[model samples]
Target: MMLSVFILMTVLSLMMKIDNSISANCYTCNPCPTPFSPSSYLVRNKTGCRYCAKIRPDGYPIVVRDCTDTCEFSTWSYMFSKYSYNCCTGNFCNKSQTNYPTHQMVILLLFTIYLFVNKTSTKI
Candidate 1:
């Protein structure tokens, strides 16, 4: 019985480490400053990123795209130019400005789980 228990523990430990890899992927771009990044490069599984994002600052022709923790679309104006930002959740979601948040959708369900518990509980 002791040996059986040890084997079970080992199996569980291995399972825990198996699925930590991030399956989500996104297009990362930063064509500015030293070590310019290509817009076609694909990025996988950032430690704290749940969503992909794209932002274009005012007055600058460059747009930077990458992973983000949240999706909050907003616009900010600073002097001459207006910056527009858009966010979405899914794999390869932040691909382009006109792509509208995704081509290869991984789904919002991937990271979120909803439990629809009934408000009424039967009493025995």
Candidate 2:
């Protein structure tokens, strides 16, 4: 019984450690510069926007002659089409991101139970 308890605690501690490490590396938004053009509408793209602007060589008196919406933002929902759009815009701790850790916790819980049962039923 004591051995089983020890093993269970050890496994739980290890799982918590793993969870902390994984969450530490989780993705977070960084303040990125706006890459959109005043003349053109912005659209989502893989890397960034791709538009043509006609500005003077001296960079004065800019004009919005033509524009296109070709700007893209870094969002988990955009990256993972399976996830809902709200996953990225709202809370950071959503199902999409918690799936992995939740799965790990479930597996660890099952394993711990199994170990406890096996240890108790074993005959010396």
Candidate 3:
């Protein structure tokens, strides 16, 4: 029972750590540069997330957060040259630019779980 409890706690802690580490904050605004304090949005899929801006160089911009390939931002950016686009992942990272994570931690977590299961099976 103690071993089971310990294992459960370890898994729970790892899950929490991964959840906190992978979450991203992005700046969200309908029209950029209008407000001094723009709202930030949360992204579920930290990978392939994007923060896009339209007409930023023109001084009036439309900024959006956590845009996927199916979003209008992707289409607009690909279809036009006037838009400034960025992608990134981190807490409030999109406040400046856009980026993405390689999900190394997720892969590592899966590997750890696999090893744990394999060890348990061997013992049984």
Best by the TM-score measure? 1
Query: Cα deviation of 77 in candidate 3 (Å)?
Result: 3.4
Which residue runs of candidate 1 sit more than 4 Å off their true CA positions? 1-23, 32-48, 73-82, 99-124
What lDDT is reached at residue 89 by model 2?
16
Error of 3 at 101 (Å): 12
lDDT of 1 by residue, 29-115 (tens): 554322333333433334345666666777777776667555555322332256677765556666655446232232223212211
lDDT by residue for model 2 over 18-90, one digit each (tens)? 5534321111222111332222233211211122111111233221111112222233323333322221111
The CA lDDT of each predicted structure is 0.49, 0.35, 0.48
Clashes of each: 0, 9, 5
lDDT by residue for model 3 over 1-124, one digit each (tens)? 4576578568767865675445344454544444324432322223434332222433435554443333244465544556665544454555554344434556566767876887899798
How well does candidate 3 match the true structure, expressed as C-alpha RMSD? 10.2
Task: Assess the local accuracy of residue 89 in candidate 3 as a C-alpha lDDT between 0 and 100.
Answer: 40
- Give RMSD to native, each candidate: 11.2, 16.5, 10.2
- What local lDDT score does residue 11 receive in model 2, on the 0 to 100 scale? 74
Please say which candidate is ahead in lDDT: 1 or 3: 1
Q: Score residue 61 of candidate 2 by CA lDDT.
A: 28
- Give the least accurate 10-residue stretch of model 2, judged by summed lDDT: 48-57
Quote model 2's TM-score.
0.29
